[model samples]
Target: MSVWLENAIARANSTSDWLSPIRSVSLAALKDTPWPTRKTEAWRYTSLKSLERATLSPSPSVNQDTPEQIDGFESFNLVFRNGEFDLDSLTQPLPAGLMISYLPTASEEMKQASLDEFSQIKPGRHLFGLINDVLAQHVVRIEVAEGVSISQAIRITSLIGLNSESHTRVFVKLNKGASLTVSEHYQGNVESLNTGFVEYDICAEAKLEHYRFALQTDKAISLGGCHFKLGERADLNSTLVGFGSDLSRVDTDIIYDGEFATAKLNAFYLLDGKELFDLHATVEHAVPNCTTLENVRGIVADRAKAVFNGRIHIHRHAQKTLAELNNRNLLLSDKAEINTKPELEIYADDVRCAHGATVAEIDKHALYYLESRGISRSKAQVMLNFGFINELIDQMPNQVLAEWIRPQIRNRFAEMEVTR
Candidate 1:
């Protein structure tokens, strides 16, 4: 590690508590691991040198005047200033059958148990996750009781302040027959770094729809990961929308802990103005009679670049498992670039699994047809781009949320900025 990184680690350790086992694990992991490069299989297309050289600092306090409604859409909001939970702003009573508790405020028993839980996940294999675990000062834990179905979505917003590095861990649990939807929005204007880790533990017959929006300024960088474990007959639906970040990446892992579980991973990303994005998703079918569908679509304009890697693993015992993975991208400019890879590792003879990836420019023939109908070329391009991602946007559960994101997508394509 460089001197700067060593100093940053020291600063993180100083403010962090003497949490059991996590401190030792993190320090050792950081020492043994070097910054990722193109040689790393998982990061072959993305570089982390910008993030490694960052001067990390704890977030300073800022005003808490959060918006009650954004774009005329409202939901139950849990705002986090920097990486710490906003206790003062989140004083309202939680909805029925739902509970929100902060890890720093957790009881002794719960704190110790969190260590055990962290060990089980073993996030140390990934360098960023290890760093977050070792230095995380704030963690939010949400739980839904059995047989409870929440009507309103729970939204968590993490706002970065100034030149700061925010590390956070979030845990969510749903008991048998419970269902809920959770949305995570990361927005900021400062030149900062945000590292977060989230875990979802779903019991039998539970359902969860997890949505994420990363709409940071081009000066910010974001590194995050999510892990999901599903019990028998449980289901998980995840949708992600990303835009306007200097560098952003989300690594996700989904595992089936019991038979008959299902998972759907859908994402759409829009990048322009030299922005960058990377998404790595993995699904493991360890039990029989499970199903999975992974689909991602992206549009790259200007000089921006993006990467997508989707992998599905079917174990020997996971008979009758059905899984499909696909990645499609549209490049609007000659300078824009995308690297997409889809892989399937199946060990069961009785399973059907498939994966495919495609990258292409807008269809010329279709564009000509629209242009011939008196439509301007610029308007036609915007219409076609919207049609490309409309399927994924339609998958969103709420119309208000979809409408809120539509303008972001529309504005990106309508601008049609291309560099000579």
Candidate 2:
């Protein structure tokens, strides 16, 4: 075990809560879990050296950090400044049918139910996830009532400061026939460590639109996950956009628990300098008559590195399932590296599933065609790279978010200054 894990175990053992039973299980499992290395299949291409060497200490309870604002996107904001929850930042009087409560102030009934649901959707295969299960202090629960549609989205933002180590958790439940839109944002450019995880339970006929932005860069080390469980006839649409950091890794899992459900996921990333980003996704078709569509793309420049492992599992009972995953990456520098693996595990003969991955440089022919015009070579290079990821950005359902992110992606290209 790494020194970090040892300290985490000690810290987790030092505290006890009403959910101690649940935390105990995680703490025990964490003690038995060994530190991951390059030999670990799930972490084969991503290194945790940055985390192991990071200093773990108590962070300030509050900071002046504020969440990012979207001009046209109206949302109820919940901010976590440093490792502490900023309850004052929440836009209160949450509309009817919506409830937001934190661990420290949850009602007895909420606490009881939270114990049973915690970690139920997220698989235990993740090493950092287990640590999150144990060390997370800022646990927030959000629920939407049955048959209600929340038009205004709820935004959860975590702002980390320099040399801080923090863990945060979110649990969202969309009851039967409920509809909601939620976004998770993590923005920190300083050197720090953070673990943020969220789980969603979408019940029968419910719908959820989810977005996750891990935009932290530079020496920030962020490990997080978003896990979803879809029930009968449920619907889920999720979008993820990220910029690379020293050790930025995220795991996303989509599980179909009931029949006739649908999930669509799209993710894109941009890496520059020595930053590294790793994305691991798994889709579980545990029932019949389900459908899944996933698209992932990335651009790596300079000495940056990116890793993608996407898997779609079709169980034996999941007949009539349609699942497909496609991952494509662009490496603009000779020293830049990308490792992509798209996998399909189908035990049902009646299922249709496909997975593929490709990593390559920008098309020279396209560059030449653009240069044939009056476009400079450098300008042409940025255009080609931008065009590759713009396809996915254009697919974002929220035009407000898409427009906000488009210029940021352009600014990233300018900073990268990647050349042929």
Candidate 3:
């Protein structure tokens, strides 16, 4: 085992909490699981050398860090600064049918409910996820009552301080026929590490609109996972946006457990400097008549690297399943690199599934068209890159978020110009 994993195991063994029994299971599993290397199929393109000898500072000096402000986005915000939950979030009045509980101080009923639901949805395959399970002491659970529609979105933000390491987890559930929206945001810089994971259970006929933004950059190492299990006729729409950092890896999985359920996932990552970002997304069709649509894109520049692995799996009994995945990439510089794999594994003969990937540079025809219209070459490049990602950004159901993120992407394109 690498020094980092050994240290993690030690640290995990030192803690005792209300969830100790559950943590022990994961801690044991983490110990037995081999450290990944170039030969590991799941981690072939990503390296963990940065973590092998790393020293962690578990606690941060008191600082009132907060999430970035977005104009006109009204949300009930749950903020974690250096992995410490903000008490103000609990003081705010919540809308009916919404319940938020912090595990450490939860009531008996809430704690019992959380005990039953925690760690049940996310698969045990992720290394960082197992680390998160063992080290995360503070847990948050959010639930929407049956048949209720929540108009306002619930936002969860994790802000990591410099030179600190933190782990956090969240569990959310939507009962039968309920509707809700959730937004998760993480930001850290200056040589910090963070692991955050979330799981959602959507019951029959429920609909959930979700967004997760891993916006940390420049020296931050962030790892996380988001998993969902859908019930009969359930609908899920999810968007994940990633910005490259020193090392950033995120895994997302969607499981269709009931017939007629549908899921749509749209994701993208933008990288600059010498940063690295890896995203692994999986969609599982375990029941019949399910549908899935996934689209992922990336832009790499300035010697940065981006990795994508998109997989769609259809079980043998999942007849009439429809799934498709498309991945596209644009490299801004000759030194920039992208590794993409789109896979479709179908066990059912009647399933309709297709997967494809493409990697290329800026479209010269489009660039020439813009340049001929009197736009500067550099400006044309920025415009072209912006247009490449804007299609997916514009599809964001929340126009406010789309408008908020567009300018940032445009600025990155200009600052990190790539020479083909």
The whole-model lDDT of each prediction reads 0.81, 0.89, 0.90
Q: If the candidates were sorted by their lDDT against the true structure, best first, what order would they fall in?
A: 3, 2, 1
Cα displacement (Å) at residue 260, model 1: 0.4
Off by over 4 Å in 1: 2-4, 16-18, 53-56, 61-68, 71-74, 119-123, 418-420
TM-score per candidate, chains pooled = 0.94, 0.98, 0.98
Residue pairs that clash (backbone atoms under 3 angstroms), model 1: none
- Give the per-residue lDDT digits (tens) of candidate 1, residues 25-71: 77777888886778888889888766766655674666354633665
Clashes found in each candidate (C-alpha, N, C closer than 3 A): 0, 0, 0
**How much does candidate 1 score in TM-score?**
0.94
TM-score ranking, best first:
3, 2, 1
Residue 412 alpha-carbon offset, candidate 1, angstroms: 1.7
Which ranges in model 2 have alpha carbons more than 4 Å from their true place?
A: none
State the lDDT of candidate 2 residue by residue for 152-223, as single tens digits: 998889999988877899999999999999989999988788899999999999999999999999889999
